[model samples]
Target: MHEMSVALSVVDHVEQAVRPDGAHGVRRVHVEIGELAGVVPDALAFCFELACSGTVLEGAELVTRFLPGRASCAPCGRTWDTGMPPDMTCAACRGGATELLSGRELRITEVHWSAEPAAPDPGPAPHPEESR
Candidate 1:
């Protein structure tokens, strides 16, 4: 699945950024996906989890934000938000010769992590009669 590939890339990038201390782990990954990027969020999340399993990024969350598309019409010389429309027509003059503004990005924006030590477990509680 393409999600698997995307996840791999994400992990690679995060690894480069995180420096991985003894107790540190990737906590979250923020991603920005364009509406026209054709990536299924759920599928990507599923693949990401599978890819990160047993790795330093294990249990980390994947946060995604969708960016809408934009367009500029050549005929009317107007710019507008295409909203990733099916035909990508210019809303201003209904022109087809419009330049796409965005909606073709799949990038990791930021990464969050935690390096806290694991808490120690307390001894079991004493039974009613065991404690004097």
Candidate 2:
């Protein structure tokens, strides 16, 4: 499925972003998926798991935020939720002229890195006089 490819691409992005900074791996990732993005969340999740096998992103939590599709009619200067429809007319003025404002977004919003505990720093050895 295409979702598998998409998942792999996402993992590539996350790994590239975190690996340069010494991150051991990713703990979580947040992505925004719009109603019109044409991505199936369940399929994506399933593919993600497979794609992440043996990778730094393995077991990383995938948080998805669903955004509603929105469009605005230029003639009436009106905006409304477009739901899942491919095309819509202005509800206020019955105008067919419209431009999409939001939706069709499939992007990563944030990434959380696995927290590795820092090594403890030993203070300087006691002075010779104090030791005596």
Candidate 3:
């Protein structure tokens, strides 16, 4: 399924974002999924775990935030939860919708990572004469 590909892409994005900070591992990856985004959360979560195997994100948690579909009516400037169309009319005035304000998002919102281990400090080298 496409969820596997999406999961892989998420890993790529997470790596790109955390690599500069020398992050050793990912703790969690948060994402917002809209009702109209056409993605199955369960499948995506399952695929994410598979995609992250052997990577920095291995065993990382996937936090999903589900958003309800919403549409705004142009005639009356009203908004309501339409739940992904086929019934997107404004509840306030029963008018047609002009724009969709939200519920189409499918992107990573945050990435929590573990700090990389600090480099060990080396003591002063022994003197050349002491190297006998």
- Among the numbered candidates, top TM-score falls to 2
RMSD of 3: 10.9
The prediction achieving the highest lDDT against the true structure is 3
lDDT for 27 (candidate 3) = 84
Candidate 3, residues 5-59, lDDT tens digits: the string is 8899999988777354657888889999998888899999999988988788887
lDDT of each: 0.80, 0.82, 0.83
* Alpha-carbon lDDT of model 1: 0.80
Per-residue lDDT, model 2, residue 52, is 75
**lDDT score, candidate 2, position 48:** 86
- lDDT: worst 10-residue window of model 1: 114-123
Ranking by lDDT: 3, 2, 1
In Å, residue 78's CA in model 2 sits off its true spot by: 1.1
lDDT of 2 by residue, 1-132 (tens): 787888998988886773545577677788898989888999998888788777777778788999989999998798999987765888789999899888899999998887552233466999989987
User: Candidate 1: where are CA atoms >4 Å away?
Assistant: 18-23, 83-85, 117-132
Worst 10 residues of 2 by lDDT: 114-123
Whole-model alpha-carbon lDDT for candidate 2: 0.82
